[model samples]
Target: MADSGQALARRLRQLRQQQWPDTTVRQPQLARALNVSVPLISSWENESTPKVPPVSRLQTYALIFCTRRSIDGDQLVPLDETELTTEESRLRDKLLHELLDLRTVALSRTPAPGSAPANPWQFDDGNRIVIVCARLPDELLTRMPYVRPEDPDYIELYTYADLDSLFELHGHIRAFNPGGEVRRRTAKELEPDDLTSHLVLLGGVDWNDLTSDVFQVLDLPVRQVNDWGGDEGPYFSHGDRRFSPQLADGRLREDVALFYRGPNPYNARRTLTICNGMYGRGTLGVVRALTDSNFRDRNTAWLHERFGAEEAYALLSKVRVVRGQVITPDWTLDGLRLVEWPD
Candidate 1:
């Protein structure tokens, strides 16, 4: 006989704002610690229309608020459950059960709408994912007959910036996410729905407009130091440290590639991932890093180990081109990382 939604909303708000007496746990700090967006936290605490967070997210809330240890530092870091003291563990259990009971009542009264989105690039939830690729430059398009509108035998394949990167990444993504629909589009061609769905951007800021657009919105310190991943310029930079391609004898020996995975700024329910490089080879290397048969498993395992359940992170690495072949980057190996987020 109670307004369960309002009760749940009030309790969730109390856990964040009221529970922390000495240290005020701000929404932004809590969101980062919980691996969600600032807006998402607001949604849950909204007075009028509160959205029920997922059970897993509720569990994170319990872990974080159970002990002040999680917010001991300037920023909220993850609290390991195993390290929780006796009192903290008991308190966490009490908080978790209280939230769970309210969540159950709220769900029965008004069921949460829509299918929950899976992790970025994971299609197990049967959601649509859009891969946005950069278009080839005008100079290069001039040489490809299919790209010319007036050409009699035009196929339009030349419109894509990096065919190798597209081909390798598209297939790999589709195969990995059999339950979902995976679609590819040029940066300039994304539909409105595509923008809200999981977005995978390939290539660099110079060519892909979406890549540049995304970088501007994210609060990351890393950025495109140089527009073009030319022979001498660094593709991305963090502070003063630059990640540039290594070249010798006018040949690209190693190229810099960035692999970024985070909550979509457009739609927090979905994810946004960027596999990019200064050159085509570097982009291809990033794609192959997680798709390569020999190394994909190891690289993926390392990713889970390094970041855990934290959804947002970035990796800058060296993409070595050996004898014209792109060598899959082994992320677990030493000295490969140029700059990694949340270090």
Candidate 2:
């Protein structure tokens, strides 16, 4: 992505210099002539910005360059002065803008922070945002069955419902860090230090090994039994409250999910997030909690009060799904617990 920006920047700068070899065309001068921000011109020349200028801005730059180079008194160069046809110019500008847009999308996936990291969801430019997805094993898939009747293949990378919520959440994050580098990796590919960046781990212990390792080692609220997914069935431990689909409760509750945010396990300086559940509905529940505006608002309110400015915390909740959609009305915030990382 940076390569594209660099190439474009090189071409733009080269044109400016070639058009006026004797004169020293400073960035400020070009910015003033084009009526754009000096910083924007600097970004284009230095390749510092993740995205190139928009098509309109590029056109304005060309006009300014042509006006600066004209021998006659006419400020604007006529279309006939250039050998290129009107259609050819339009086609070239369209392709250039498309390339810039593609570069912007690619950069948006990474963490791009300036100075300090304020929001856990947003990061600095050039930083990595690693989203670790779970790939379930065949044996584990056979053992832990999904409570949602419609759910299929627990071991799959991600279900459509999960992707729906994830895609929405990712889009929001991209808005803040358009130049950041985003990546997706499986549990098997992750190293200890890989957790040091802005990390988001999807799925639960039964499928996501990272979740299993964290809960087991950190003494977090969520717990897994040895006979988990067996006759006793999968469940999560939260102090005196134990949430499980097998608990035989009269309530219409069908699944449980966990959402955690905190410092990375390997490096406390970075951020990590966990969105997982005992079943597919539960996973979808976590995704909804992150993306759905109403759901996120309620959860954020609960978090602010419960955690009280803490940097790390966990959210344990349950959701009911009917016909492939999580019923938000039936959702409940079971537990909002703070995480005490080891010093």
In the range 169-219, model 1's lDDT, one tens digit per residue, is 788778778878989899888898999998899988888999999989998
Q: Model 1: how far is 269 from its true place, Å? A: 0.4
What TM-score do all the candidates reach, one by one?
Answer: 0.63, 0.51
Instruction: Give me the candidate number with maximum TM-score.
Output: 1
Model 1 shows how many backbone clashes?
A: 0
Task: Name the regions of candidate 1 deviating beyond 4 angstroms.
Answer: 1-120, 227-232
Estimate, for each residue in 1-343, the C-alpha lDDT of model 2 and write its tens digit: 4565676677677756775666556666666556778777777777665345654465555444444442224232323326555655565445444333433333333324532233346566456787776754655445655623467744333422245545655776676579987766677788765777788877777667777787765656556553553776677765665667523344335676777787777777777788776766667666666456544433433343345456777766666665556655212222222222221
Q: How badly does each model clash, as a count of residue pairs?
A: 0, 14
Candidate 2 regions exceeding 4 Å error are 1-120, 124-126, 138-168, 191-193, 226-229, 246-253, 329-343
How does residue 80 of candidate 2 score in lDDT? 31
CA error at residue 253 for candidate 1, angstroms: 0.2
